[model samples]
Target: MRHHFSEQLDLVFDELAELCITVQIAVRQATEALLAGDGAAAERVISGDLDVDERRDRIEVRCFRILSLQQPVAGDLRTVVAALRMGSEVERSGDLAVHVAKVARLRMPRTAVPDELIPVVTRMSEIAVDMMGRTASIVAERDIAGLVELRALDDEMDDLRADLLQKIVGPGWTHGVEPAVDLALLSRYYERIGDHAVSVAKRVDYVITGERP
Candidate 1:
């Protein structure tokens, strides 16, 4: 019975890892589409989000099955709970990517986004993706220090968010309201993605330390 239970747990973790991969790909594609103003790429990201959504549901159901049948205890219990929380974060990450793609679609033809902010946005996406990858590794390793380091990404994202906002609100923002608003909202969504990545790290920290960070 214990062996069977362990096998099921491994399957659950595998599914969760796949969900993270889907999210990471979606986010990268969305950022690339935004930077290039590629409407077709944006549409692809939007459509691909449904796959992530379905995978999230599968993860959640598998987690519940483990709890209901396996009745995991102690450390195993932590893993099950972490799986549930991580599933939600993965779903939210996909949603953020979709949101970015939607903004890309909306701002087509005119490309309201300021050229100066492209690098900043790109850097923010890179950081968020890295942090998420780190969080997933931390969960697998149960390393407290590694999990704590992921929190620092949040501060970097905050700084980038502020810088982007300042640029949009500064003199160069005289371009027009539509572009400014799109840029502002897109920056915000990217920042939120960073937050969600941090949230995942914190959830992993909780599973390891049994205390929320």
Candidate 2:
């Protein structure tokens, strides 16, 4: 029975790892679509969101099943609880990526990002993807190895969001208010992606250390 319970716990971990990977791919794909003005790619990202959400739901169900069957105690309980919470965070990240794709689609043939601001949005996407990949590692290792790294990535994301905003509102911004609004919304989407990745790390840390990081 103990071995079977351990196997069940492992399933929860495996599902979470897959969930993280799905989210990371969504971020990368959405960023590509946003930058390239690829409506097809953007559509792919939008369609893929349902798959990620379904996987998240499966993870939640697995967590509850383990708890109901095994009645996990102490650290075991912590791990299961953390998995449930982290799955939701990852699902939100996936939704953010979908939002990015929707923005790209909204712009139609024209790229949503202005030429000058491309570099800023590109950098934000890179950092968001990096942080999300690190989140998977954090869950797999069941350690705080990426805790500090996640925080630093989030800080960079925030700074990038601010810089993007300044460019939009600054006198030099000639892209017009509509385009500026699109960029502003895009920056927020990427920043929120970074935030969700950090939240995943914190949840994993809690499971391992039995204390909030």
| Cα lDDT, all candidates | 0.80, 0.88
Residues 1-213, model 1: lDDT tens digits? 789887887787677767777788888888878888888889999999889889989988988998999898987888788889889888898999999988888878645467876788889889877876776666555565775566677888899889878877888666677877887888888788878777776776777678755
- lDDT, model 2: 0.88
Q: Write the per-residue lDDT of candidate 2 for residues 1-213, one digit (tens) a residue.
A: 789888887788778878888889989999889999888889899999999989999998888888998898988888888889889999999999999999999887888888888898899999999998888888876777779978998998998898778878999989898889988888999999899888889888788778875
Clashing pairs in model 2? none
TM-score of each: 0.90, 0.96
Error of 1 at 27 (Å): 0.7
**Lowest summed lDDT window (length 10), candidate 2:** 204-213
Top candidate, metric lDDT = 2
Error of 1 at 67 (Å): 1.1
Query: How many clashing pairs in candidate 1?
Result: 0
Candidate 1, residue 208: how far the Cα is off, in Å: 1.6
